[model samples]
Target: MNAPYSRDCGPPPWAGSGGAPSPRPRRVPWLSTLLVAVLVLAGSGFAAKGQPDRERLDAYALALLLLGTALLLARNRWPVASLVGTVATALVYLGAGYPYGPVCTPTAVAAFTVVVAGGLRAALWIGGGFLAGHALIGHWLYQYLPPTGDPGVPWGREVVFAAWVAAVLTASELVRVRREAWARERLERAAAAKRRADQERLRIARELHDVLAHSISVINVQAGVGLALLDSDPEQARTALTTIKAASKEALGEVRQVLDSLRTPGDAPRSPAPGLDRLPELVEQAAGAGLNVTVETVGVRRPLPPGTDLAAFRIVQEGLTNVVRHSGSRVARVRIGYEAGRVVLRVDDDGPATGSDAGGSGNGLAGMRERAAALGGTIDASHRDDGGFRVRADLPAPVKETV
Candidate 1:
């Protein structure tokens, strides 16, 4: 709900206000007393044979009047209790010659309270009770007061009073419902934002885990090999050192790619996202890491969408990482081909693996599959019969424009 009232008014114990601000102040004890005083003055103004019955509303009537008025101040917070007090005061006022002053105000407020708190049904029943008690007692008073020729209680006055009470109650209820609806909408928006944030975090987490885990794993192995061969075979050690350098550089580039995603506004443009054009560099990096990385492209090629191209690049990068980490031999094949209505990619390695070697647990494969599916494509992953792993992705080819 919109914020509640900022301050306390009069600090009256009867003010039952909390949560959102009420249309009226929480406590109006002084207002209630003033209203009661006005009602007493008005009742005292009623004429009996050319002179006002100023003494008719004595101490008893005045006490009932004040009690009923006080109840009005607490109607919102303690609706049922205030309603009971108003009803009882109405009876007392009627028995004591109909104090028309503050008598009706408290009952009217109580009826309104029921309506706003309990909807139309409560308003209807409470209003009906009010009218019945008031009309019955008013008719009795007319008979007992020795007719002052003021014409009996007109039906229009009761109708007008009921209409005024109903209008106030309904308007308050409508405002309450609208406020609640706005609050619910705000809550739904917050929940949706939280869900989107969580999904984004998971996407970034998977990308970092695949890139860093796979890249650093290769660097670690190459470093170990180079350290072992430092004395007997200096040439092979040199080659291992060279491979380590290339892997470290590629790893740094991949890290930079990840960091660029977090740039603030007005920052310089990042390195362009890797796509098909960077396939040659990717293959060379893998070849330097001791895996035979090869590339073959066919058909008429055109510029692909960034998302599609990025997906293709990551699939290749991850597949090559897998080959070096899983397979023991140096020969891994890469293939990229464009054909009718589709672009196909495949990476297979026929390298020998020792008993301790294990292929990936399939997170990278799943990420590739998800990316391909997002573009209305598919992917397949399985082990080759030649004792190696194969990763394949098929992406729908965008129709090229004939310029």
Candidate 2:
């Protein structure tokens, strides 16, 4: 059976795979080309002595230098092929007694490219092959030719050559690992930013739903009452119309506050976020909408973190909105309790679940739950055994001394 493909280990999506042609490689950098050229020209000056003709030796050295430079240009596009060519050319130049110093430069550069493109395994194999070839060839040459200088290629010198190749391979591998790590970090940052944006969008949607749905439901009921009393009693109709006008105006102001916050610059003026201080206004609004609401507070009042305060207010707003819209109750009660390290809110209604209620699919309860969770709080909402719905929330806060 074929091995399964792992996305984590694969190349980036833009890099085609599965036999498809990969994207064109980037052009060779000018700095790299210049470096290669410099190495080749420097190598050409070190032609070995005792050639049959001095001029012919110089020409052969020039030809090898040009070939190495040309091969280096294609290193990135076909790194393995270019590496092989470079190593082979260097070995041939050295074998032909064209001096050893400059010839090794191209081989070192090729070893680096092999490691960077094909990883350490490729570098090890290619480097080992070159080392073996050099040892064999040097042994053969020393056996046949008479010694020109001291110690005929000391073993220490061969050790140094192997070390140079190993150093280049190690450096290339370090760079490749760092580049991959940077790419992975960038991907993670992008994913995190996307998640935050999604959460913000959901929160804003919930705010709009609670604001609009509650106000519209009240306006709709008052408008019907006005229409009905218009024929019998003008005074009551006027009162109903006035109530609708007030509810609409208040809703508009609240909606504008939300929208302005979204559009305003960070340093721009912004309206204060609603909190428990606005609970009385909310209760009055519900009373105007024909639902009797009473609010009770226990324990001492204290300041809260801005986030916790806003979340607390929203939970209360959502709970009361659900009572007004979903529960077919004439009276609702809101109870707020302040404790040593937390604040609690409980909104209960005299509900006998009506078939007209929007039911469990509504976003109001979900929004309340989300708000509480975001503030490291907890919320519970369910129908009571005594024939009413209850929403209870507990939010963390710092303990403050009573004034």
Candidate 3:
């Protein structure tokens, strides 16, 4: 027989095997590459115009510019390596006295990429290296070389170049931090949604177990009685079969009500869930299954929270079902007591336990305890000293306010 509510609460559908989250796809660097290429081409053209040999562009200079642009293509995977290669190419191109404008373009883009990949600390180190290298090579060494008729190192231009590099590095770091923050927010939302779905599934499973277990246990007992009496007494067998049919029909309706609630939201009216008001019908069903049951109440009856009422009803129903199925007992008693701040329930049976249906893993008892605990209540179920089983539950009641 299939268990009513056995289901694996595995990961959400989007999750990978064993509930591990899939790795995020790597972002493409095409946008950055295109921007860098445009800057490199434009800077190279402007620098060539200022060249004394503008009519004849040096092949070596053109080759170095192409090399720097190619290095940027691998920036996403090998950021530090690409940064180093581009910076080195720019230094060599400047030392060759080809042009200065294009060299700064690659250096700036490479520094920005490093900042994006390695964050603020890396930007600081690379930016510092670029500043020191420019001071030593471009400013100091270029002043002594007189072949190109270079005027000299200008302090104003040097200061402006340092500021531009610093601005690019700072902007890259800010953008990287913002992107990381957005990714973290997305992950948090996904985790929260998964948690909600798991909780909902658990609630549905509990409801199904309580509803199906009680109804099916009674039906099984009635059907067994009908089969045995069909040989000896046709009249009693007909009564047992009728009881089985009624129990099965009611069980199907209740199951459909639960499923409908899951399928539709809003205020579509349906049959109300079983509560204390349905306890009489439950007792009649048990009596028809060959168990003599009695119910008694003490103190004034009061309305309860809908959840608490349903839980209390289920606990009682499960207790009676266990007595009929496992205790081999003919007589069962139930008592309800309303007190100052709580409601109490007790179910007891007179029995010599058959042990055929006893010694179960006690999933039914566990379900009862879970229900009680959910409403800030407690339940105790055990074999009585008088050779029977007893289940007692204490449920908290809301305090009344004086006007």
- Summarize candidate 1's per-residue lDDT along 1-403 as a digit string, tens digits: 0111110001122222221224564554455445544653354344211233222656776677777767766766777777778777766665455323334555555655665565557666666676676566555565554324323355665666566556656665776678678879999999999988776776676667666766676677778778999998899999888888877887788778777766784676477777889878777767666667767777777777787888888888888877777777677777888877778889888856554544455577778887788789899988878878888999987866788
Better of 1 and 2 by TM-score: 2
Can you tell me which runs of candidate 1 are displaced by over 4 Å?
A: 1-120, 138-152, 263-269, 337-342, 351-362, 384-387, 400-403
TM-score of decoy 3: 0.79
Query: How far off is model 3, as Cα RMSD?
Result: 13.4
lDDT of 3 by residue, 209-304 (tens): 777787788888888889999999999999999998988887898888777667656856488888999999899989887889899999999887
- Candidate 2: where is the Cα deviation over 4 Å? 1-39, 42-63, 142-151, 261-265, 357-361, 400-403
> Compared with the true structure, what per-residue lDDT tens digits does model 2 show for residues 137-245?
5665645532242124456656766776666677778766776688799999999999988987887787777777777767776787899999899998998889889
Candidate 3 clash total? 0
Quote model 1's TM-score: 0.72
Q: Give the local distance difference test score of model 2.
A: 0.69
**Separate clash counts for every candidate:** 0, 0, 0
User: lDDT scores for all predictions?
Assistant: 0.65, 0.69, 0.71
Which of the two, 1 or 2, has more lDDT?
2
